[model samples]
Target: MIDIPSMQRAGANAVKAIIDDVISEKLDVEKKFSSSKTAFRIADLGCSVGPNTFIAMQNIIDAVQQKYQSQGFASHMPEFQVFFNDHTSNDFNTLFASLPPERPYFATGVPGSFHGRLFPDFSLDFVHSSFALQWLSKVPEELLSKNSAAWNKGRVHYASAPDEVAQAYTVQFAKDITTFLEGRAKELVVGGLMVLNMPGIPNGNPHSSSVTGLSFDILGHCLVDMAKEGLISEVQVDSFNVPIYVASPKEMT
Candidate 1:
């Protein structure tokens, strides 16, 4: 559920900040945008089914509404449209049901990695993603087929890991980043700003045995227990690490 007070403040402020940044300098995405009707096209990439998402969407709308109104652009009342997207597996039904009947915003499930063409060429004015995109996809089979010291080289239960497993995870994360940027470059119209806010390891660290601290170690232990129970295999447990990205922000940049 949407936290009433928190969202009313943070969500609202986040929307205002983005709009202000773009509209003020005519910077980022709003720079090249010239529209007669003022129909602004905005999108929230990786919008999941939740109150936070809804609240954020509303906040963005409110900010944009206030923006054009103040500019004497009120007469045209820039036609407004919002697109809420997530991976295809997202619970769109839940999102839509939570939405009001009037539907001030339009919502859709794009069902693909948000890093790519969620919209047509030069279509978006602003794009926002909160708390999504970190996971790499399922580990590849070839890497884990052998439960050996080579593939499953680091079989420690909790505290340690081998270098190769780390490499496999890192490689996938880089691929995800590249894919994401490639898609965004094509979809976002020049001047469109795509704000991606997600958790990352401090600085530009590749998530490593150095990072993840103890939490991931606990996760590894759980996996080992599961493997012993036959809930999974040594091969499965061999592939550790969150599928999500934990790389440094500079790397993402």
Candidate 2:
């Protein structure tokens, strides 16, 4: 089985590498911002209640400072303002309580789905999302429609399902991604960078081949068994679907 924390660590390391190499050239630190604050703005979209988000944000702050120092602009270093965004149901209190006591950045919690616009135009200097995009806004409605060809009768995910079911998920994902990209495009300032770290399968591979897919398959079977044993209704089992779409590399492109 693939360890989730390991994957998250790998993504964080990749983010660090990108920031170290290109951030200095890509971002214009001296540019006059529309906001009156003396702080550099960063948004971590889909940041769950965790220490990993803190680690990633710190890495960014350090890299930005290094960039300024290397360019002999250390005396005018900007304060850091970090926005931690996630679903409204997330435990913001816990996230705030666990923050590092001596952290340099001023943190704020923003609750909303990243698929929609959450920030004002040209508001963010850098944006980051880690291991969060697989979750769709909601389960594809076709999967729950008895009259639809894509109805996922006994399954809780697209994996190992019929082509119609998978296609339904793909279409929904495409729409959701378009909305997400448009929002980010409007939110990020000119010369700003956005780093996204999401799970994906290799090109030409079926989602069912991955561990996540297999886990969903197992869950679907368990639910079916439960229905058979009268623990849940068959209709309920038919209506339930996991709102995640683990895209392949091709799908992502």
Candidate 3:
């Protein structure tokens, strides 16, 4: 498994802010769910192996319950059906094994890519993704083609890449995000809520100078060192690139 304590810590730190924002938008939830008498259907997109996913889902459930109760609809509280989605190759057995016995909602695993259609139209009431959208569906094909202007030579990502390479990645990210939104739009019911949390570059900051960019630079240096030590070939390093892009808020909008 990918053991990154810092990553988990960062995710935990952001959870409160995310939950608060979602709760503050209770008016929207009330509007959507007030008339519904059926079980609430929630989909946690890109929800990887758990603890964090559990916390997020519980917070959403609590927020929804509180919203309905505040509206004097305590008797109308709906059952929850939570779907944890991830790639087909993900270790779903491990994810399901760690579920808490006291979970308030019924849970199931949905293995598929979020960049494409994974559910039927208008079937979901809430959707969430955390620290996941930065991952592109696939690397930009142009970056790997020697004849393409966006050839990403001597690098694994767009951190210090040339303008053309950076542009290629940016274009690819836009396309992926568009596909993701389109898929979600078709799946979610009217007034449904979607919360997406991803790494982003600040406005007025250079993309290559951001904290995430710098981290990628350090990783690239390590890969270069490995190549020098004959642990891997320089050509392999040049050919391989991370299918991740830290977009700006403006880009997302």
Candidate 4:
């Protein structure tokens, strides 16, 4: 059984703090942020199947609502929409089926990556991607553009991978970040915020299979073992991944 709840909470806590601190402190621009009734517009990118995503979404909604109500508009609450996103492999039925109908919030699933834009132009205010950006896309076909080795299909996990392999994965991730930031920038109306949190080892990452570098390795391995046991057909893990984000307070503002 996967502890999706705990995993969701850990990630959600990051967003919660970011939202709260932003609302309380100086997020982008307070006057600009407060000008709208929405208070905060957010998206949970890479939110997989589980109750945790919903809880986190609800937490953000509640916080934003409270922020709005305290502003003296308790009767006329603002509208908000948070799109839950993930790869095509994610269990959308499970995620949507589990969505609590009692909540008065708009939610939907965007089939793609948080690293990719899911909404139309200028359609968001805040974006939260937790614990998911670390996993690079399977691999780019042109990984060998500069004569690098091809990424094998069975090489599961990115921790402790060869330098070149890791570089390939890292480069792909950078492309994703470029896509994500560029897309979000177009959608955000000047004062939007994006909070991206994932597992990363500061500067001690070395090329080795036993790198125990990221906590996500545990989740990925469970999937690997399932594949090994024939529970899941095959495994195609990236040999390298660099868990780094390219967002700053200046860029978000």
Cα lDDT tens digits, model 4, 168-245, are 555676777677678888877666666676544434435342223343456556666777887766533433333432
RMSD of each: 4.8, 2.1, 2.2, 5.8
Error of 1 at 79 (Å): 2.2
lDDT of 1 by residue, 1-253 (tens): 2233453346445555765565545532223335433456777777777666666666666666566666655555555577888888898888878876665666655566665566777777677777666656555333554664436522422224565656665667787778877777777766666666555566744344434434566667777888889888877667553454456666676
CA lDDT, every model vs. true structure: 0.61, 0.87, 0.83, 0.62
Best by lDDT: 2
Residue 237: error of model 3 in Å?
A: 0.6
Supply the TM-score for candidate 1: 0.75
For model 1, the superposed segments whose C-alpha errors exceed 4 Å read 1-24, 27-34, 101-103, 138-160, 204-213, 229-232, 239-241
Worst 10 residues of 2 by lDDT: 29-38
lDDT of 2 by residue, 23-123 (tens): 77776766733334467889999888878899889988998889888877788788989999999999999999999999999999999999999999988
Which regions of candidate 3 deviate over 4 angstroms?
1-9, 12-15, 23-36
TM-scores of the models, in the order given: 0.75, 0.92, 0.92, 0.69
Misplaced by over 4 Å in model 4 are 1-5, 26-41, 140-158, 204-253
Lowest lDDT block of 10, candidate 4: 244-253
Query: How well does candidate 4 match the true structure, expressed as C-alpha RMSD?
Result: 5.8
Q: Write the per-residue lDDT of candidate 3 for residues 1-253, one digit (tens) a residue.
A: 2344457447755775776667556436456555656778898888888878888888888888887787687787789999999999988999999998999999999999999899999988889888889999999999898999888877888988888988988999999999999999999888777888777887757778977777777788898999999999999988999898989888987
Q: Cα lDDT of model 3 overall? A: 0.83
